[model samples]
Target: MALGVWSPSLIDVVLFVIAAVVVWKLERRRRRGWATGRLPPGSEGLPVVGETLQLIAAYKSENPEPFIDERVRRHGRLFTTHVFGERTVFSADPEFNRMVLGAEDRTVEGSYPSSLSTLLGTHSLVVMKGARHKRMHSLTLARLTSPTAIREAKLLLHIDRLVRRTLDSWASSSLVLLLDEAKKITFELTVKQLVSYDQRKWIESLRREYLLLINGFFSIPFPSFLSFTTYGRALKARRKVEEALKEVIRKRKLEKATTRFDVDVNESQNNKKKKDMLEELLEGEAEGMTDEAVVDFLLSLLVAGYETTSTIMTLAVKFLTDHPRALAQLREEQEGIRKKKKDEEAALDWDEYKSMPFTQCVINETLRVVNIIGGVFRRAKTELHFKGYTIPMGCKVFLSFRAVHLDNEYFDDARTFDPWRWQKNAAAQQVGGPTVYTPFGGGSRLCPGYELARVVISVFLHYLVTRFNWEEAEKDRLVFFPTTRTLKSYPINVRRREEEEGA
Candidate 1:
């Protein structure tokens, strides 16, 4: 070896190689628990990558259930697998799922991929924890379900008007992508409820940005600065969404401040303005919540209200279309309500909306079959034990609602699109019990907008069945990866029922 620039000798090279191997082994063991028999039975797959590729691949295929089903067969309902750069426990058992969800903030906390957390922001309700999460969650639920909100006749009238207008536009269309139309209705409804903004151009543009943001939820989390990457584009979209929301908040605050005492008392009494969600949050129960928190909170609601509800609407229509008997029955029920109305233009009331037992059954069946949310990701806050298996602290736990919902053990003919099942089974009527049915999720994190979602979908279905007849424009299939949506947006050719009757 040269004095100034010495090359490694054989012993030194051997020792370095040995150290590298040891470190790699330790990392592998740490991730997979190679030395412990306590972790659930399963394989971690290839190091670093783990089963993420397989998971993604399976989800992209026509049937995504096999990924869990196959694993469950081999490793039982609760199994260990490394996915999304972490050691995760996938639970297919309804009892265990209930326990995990019930354990929120105590033993487990909300967890998601880095991509989702980044897009949703630290202040988002989905990622929020402890008292902060509890406060916001309660506030959101109260506002959404309050007497002045969804339960009000005015709000129900608004929803009916929006659904009617949307379907009216689709009446003359040669081709309609049901999913896109559903999104338009839901986005407008959510925006109106949130900020009282209903301008077509602004809602459309913001919805486009939201679509991009959603695309990145299941994408690679790092290297987000690269403009071309899906995650990168999603981040950009999120920023735009945040800025747009902030501007809305700014304008709203300004307007409120400017008009605080300037209104004529008589005029104000004659014309009472309904408070939107933004207004509610501004004067929120959760004290001292910042603008950023408000933005993130509203963004989360937008995602839930717009994407998930729209998807449900589309899937409900598709399922109804496929099962003609169910469709005929649903149409009859909706038409019965329509006949009782004063006139064709009269809007549905809260009582009428709640009166649709068959509609609720249809919505429940759609949620069960489609499993729009699929499951949730929860991180174990401490070492946990369940049914003799030990879950190490910090392990990601996936409560597979899809697995539970579709299990033949819980639901008879689980794969069938049977709305009548709800009518027969008493337990199925309760939508979020966690043990058997959890379409809107379970425990503390159950969706606040579940009832609202039902209302929106029910109203849409009422108008759709009463006014229009539609058939598929082309065959399309459901894709579950990233999100559950139709490959072709479920295009359909629709005709007004009056026109059809006249013909």
Candidate 2:
């Protein structure tokens, strides 16, 4: 090495050291400002990136527990880690999480990553707060869950057709990736149910763009340069989806007006007039809701309606395949229901869906095991104290349901896949209090689509277990970060029931 010349490696080491020093100083200054109260113990990590890389790495790993486990060992159940560019108090303590969840909008309110708010839109339901949030939530729920809105025979037929077509598509293939296929089913279902839009026409391009938009939700808050960076691509994808949805909204409005003039209200009401979420929103718009709110509502519903439900449905297959006894029980339950039905092709009605107690147990078990929604994010509305630690006003808090659901204290033998645990008098069934094992979240901010998601999963599972049998082609390489999913999309070999019986 030359004595007077600096090598590239030397320059890199020098920069790293300088960066470390700067980060340490900034963290210390920030801590000093919060020294008035006892804050939760944990690291904020390096400057800019903070603990995000570590958090993301854990999520990508097959075993994500170590990330929270190691932290809990160091800082107890209630600790702090900076994730998604915010200093967050991550609570694995079930009691504390419940308090925070119940205190929504009092001491804390919903907060999400900047990328999510940006991609979802400024008026997204997930980010909306106060009176506006309440109004949107009420209207959205009424439209989604109303008795009249839910009984649309056309919508049920569409779901049946889509599910069957998806299964048929996979029948010829030797290997099927559940996540990929599940996404197809969910995306199409949400599109039809929410907007009455036939996705087959634009599904390929739209799915690609939608994925780009999703990736942006996890990307670093980097400035988009020439629409080339991850963030830039996300922004572009959002614009494309927004435009497409806007066009659909416009067309629907015109159609609604045309229909209004074509038929009398009494005549139309007398008929089985099918109404989707868009139609309900159009009605609301006529009552004075803004177009922007309608678009945001549609976009938010696409995510809420599809992503988590699809993830859970895919995981149900994985878990069922791994546990044959449970699979057999589920098959028996589903088969019994099928045999009792006069029409084999008839879709599961709301009452029929409600009758499947064992199936609901399976769904609950899958939700607990998969923990698709890692936690809920809320910002402290005022200075708050929990377990003798202070969370200064505006500090971000993440209620870690994953930790709680998996904790042995809350769920005996929690790591195992045991749907039977949800059965009456089962140990696991007795363990949950009001908020323990809250996979759907809790309080006012709990997912309003919870019931709808449950029904969707149940319907898919009913058709799946009765119509087909699946075996994993390879061991699942499950990823837990950002969300719980498969590294390779969880490929499996599926066979139709008739083919399997013949073989």
Candidate 3:
């Protein structure tokens, strides 16, 4: 009986060894195929986690480009690495990036990791493609960029009032963290524009939730029920946002439904038509869009709108303070506009806004140097061949905006923050022809809120430069990983322009 039992155990062990050998051979063959044939050069790191940690670290580093820079040195511009649980192709080639963006569905598709997709929701404009994307883009573009929309929006006046309130509150304080203050300003403006809500009541709560969600976007995905976990907290934040928005949407729908049969056009109690972006979207729903789609679109708008504008605004101040000449030129332009006004309180109209060419140049320079969106993510719909290498089917592609923006080949002394570079043909050429300067991305996927962001930044710069003078409170620091922000909230000392003049 002992002999028989030992023999059976030996047989089981032999079978297990045979199975292991088979798996080993198959994996070896697969790796050989990847190396000898189509896939680009690079290590994917260990399985499951891949190179995620390294990529995250790079983003968090002071010089964020080294992540791609080091890899490009080893494996050329287009190389493969595993990121976010999938094999990804990182292309720092500007021409290639422009081509892929222009190609759209013809060569690849818009894709994000499941974590991001889940957070953004199914109906987000980020995920929409082809005909659906075009339709949504058109709808959004009409409302966001059209001359009529800009004229009717009166964004500058509202932004000015909001900025005044913010500065007034900070006047008593000697030091102000500009990045933190800028976030509050942008968030308030975005909320007001999107839904016409009174932001004073909701801004703090929404800001808290949005912080959680943004962090979770780049955090490693882990299954957890505890709110302390990144994904769990993100989910909780999403729920809060959804609940708050659901009520607003419901109320708007009620208003729309209640006014359907009125012979004369129904209006608010003040006898005026609703003018917010939400009102425009609800009208679309009346024409057959879903409630979830509207909510997702609105949330995506918030994601696109607030942080980027705030970061750039903070950077603008930083760069201006460092370069006194640029600051003087900026002030000259804005001051000229101010002189055109009847008084400091006079509203900035569309004409006045468009006339500030120098201010626009400063905005562009800030976008370039800061590289707010370091890259754009796309996935191969099929095998893609470029520059004599093959990008395999379904691989993720990172169009490195940072690489293109800072490349010496594209810009003379690209590292410098010279807004005047934009005033010349150098910067404009980047946008023309091959389209290298993609601060807002390119093709049909271009950010619908680009013009809106421009308006917001310009207005903020106008008020800040013309009203208050500020200087760095200490040797300020910044980080670019996950996203661009100050090492410390970017504190600075502020004094009124009048006080500066008197002193």
Cα lDDT over the full model 2: 0.79
Query: How close is every model to the real structure, measured as TM-score?
Result: 0.91, 0.88, 0.88
RMSD of each: 5.6, 4.5, 6.3
lDDT of each: 0.85, 0.79, 0.79
lDDT of 1 by residue, 255-370 (tens): 86767656645466435544777887876542587888889889988888888898899999999999999999999998999898888688888889878999888999899989
Which run of 10 residues does model 2 get worst, by summed lDDT?
424-433
Higher-TM-score candidate of 1 and 2: 1
Candidate 2: which pairs clash?
59-481
Best by lDDT: 1
- Measured by TM-score, how close is model 2 to the native structure? 0.88
Give the candidate number with the greatest TM-score. Answer: 1
Q: Model 3, 1-503: lDDT tens per residue? A: 89987997697689867865775566456556556347768888865457888987877777767777889889987888877766788888887888898889888889877777788888888888888888878877787555566667666678778877888887799799998999998898888878888757677888888888887886655554657788889988988888888888898878767667553453454355557779877655325767777888888878888888888888888989989999999999999999878876777778888999998888888888887777788988777888778776656898888887888888789888888987786444543246778888887888777777888788888888888888888986687666664455888998888877998
How many clashes does each candidate structure show, in the order listed?
0, 1, 2
